[model samples]
Target: MRARIAGVAAYLPEHTLTSAGVEARVRAAGGGYRPHPTIVERMTGIASRHVMRDDQQASDLAAEAARRVLAERGTGPERLDLLIFGSASQDMVEPATAHIVAAKLGATCPVFDVKNACNSFLNGLQMADALIRTGQHERVLVCTGEAPSRAIRWKVRDRAQFVDAFAGYTLSDGGAAMLVEAAPDGGIFYRDFAAVSAAWQVGTLPGGGSMHPRDPEFTYFSGDGRRLKDAFVDNGPEIFCTALEKTGLTWDDFAIIGVHQVTMPYLEVLRSILDIPAERLVVTLPEHGNVASASLPLQLDTAIRSGRCGPGDRVALIGLAGGVSLGVIFAEL
Candidate 1:
């Protein structure tokens, strides 16, 4: 038995932030700020990014993507057995984001949010698969919405960290939804997934959660990237390798690799560490930056639609996020 995707959809922000635009804002703000797209361009490999307006929320963007997924699959919310939302950005602290997305979609299904930082979606996928495999549910809708642009702290003290955090430039406002069903036949399939967490040292916002005690200014739930490279280096390869092993496969066995890419170095490093082909890696960070959890799904949808991926294409979604959480997932596209 295999848990496979029935449909895939994405929602990208209407706003575009270019190199010139970012420079202009930094220069005008002038709190010892200057325009620098060098790392952003090199790391994310994206030339531009989509940003959500202050008025927009993660649920709004997620609903848009969910609509696309449902339409593409010819599915209605009424038929959905379970809806899982993977989000770090939520409108309220008490209500789960999944319920909000369901409400917006006119869905009356059992819904909840899965949050493991940027790893939320992959975790959600795993849980949905477990539920389906155990005959607990069918037609599980998996959603990932990230509006990290809202929480960006442009003023950082660390220069090297900021360069990689240049992911901020590539990080955009968007969401992705995919319909996962029990498939014993041909369909996009999930092979395996694994997660690990270190000390939660690298990525985090100062305020918002109970640990920091929320403040008005910290409402965005931002993050710090001072040691992003360290976070990736610490556990990315290990978790990714474990997933591949669980599936009885190797990095070289897959046709395409899609790591949770926020930077170009992430790909290069993972490729080198795992001894996978550079060409085997499918990257969208250069064009879209990091769409948070949506990054992989959005890029995967585009790659499939654009003929870059084909029937029987095996792709890997691997990366690390805040809380020092790291993981990898194997998908058969």
Candidate 2:
């Protein structure tokens, strides 16, 4: 048996924060350095991003998307043989967020969390596929609730701080769920992943860990965006290119290719590198911002709803995370 993605769902909060609004907030915070108007949009190509309500937790967003997936499949959470909560953000640090999500959805299945920066969902899918192929489980729910906005640094102290926290400005709070089940026919066909562990310092959320357990200063996200980009570029696209070579498939073979998007320039760079057709790509960063682990699923759901891709169609999920990891998962929907 193979693991197939049976259902995909996404949820974005109603509230939006425009790039200009981000600058306004920074200025309002009485930071010493004042940013020029439209700088955020100009640099990142992100017009706006979703913001979760103050009362909403990461589990709440994940549960919302999971509910939609369960409803669409005409099943209940209890039927899920496994649930994986995959995200960069969590409601807390003690209990795995998966447990919290399971409680909210009334699911008693075995659960755990997968954290690998933005590639969390892709890793979760990879694990689910392996487990199903090994006959350990029949159905798995892979979900993510990313509230990166909660850690965004609005109080910019200077140009250095702003540049370090630039990546946070592109983040948007959202949730996504993908139901993977056993299918004797079409399912995940190929997957590849690579990472440069030495590049881990390129980006980070330093709070809640042993290094900075009580340091309020480490609560916000900090990173060198240029370094992170350089790390990926240096790591190269062998994972994706090798997949195509080994599978005898070209970019055109996939009906839809959902690449984890951060900025328009970077997306174009990757597309050019891989030679993916324009029509096959989904551009969500402009309006949705970078939804972290939710980005790929959001693109898949959009493509399915927009009639861009459907059942029996070939799809590719390409992931890039801050840890400078790369991944590719090709499947037949």
Model 2, runs deviating above 4 Å: none
Per-residue lDDT tens digits for candidate 1, residues 103-220, read 9999998998988777788788878877887878878999977887777656544555345345455567789998998877554344444444455654555565686676755533
Kindly list the per-residue Cα lDDT of model 2 for residues 85-134, writing each as its tens digit.
99988999979999999999999999999999999999999999999999
User: Which parts of model 1 are misplaced by more than 4 Å?
Assistant: 35-39, 42-44, 155-167, 185-196, 217-226
User: Where does candidate 2 clash, by residue pair?
Assistant: 312-333
For candidate 2, the TM-score is 0.99
State residue 38's C-alpha deviation in candidate 2, in Å. 0.6
For all predictions, the C-alpha RMSD in Å is 2.9, 0.7
Worst 10 residues of 2 by lDDT: 229-238
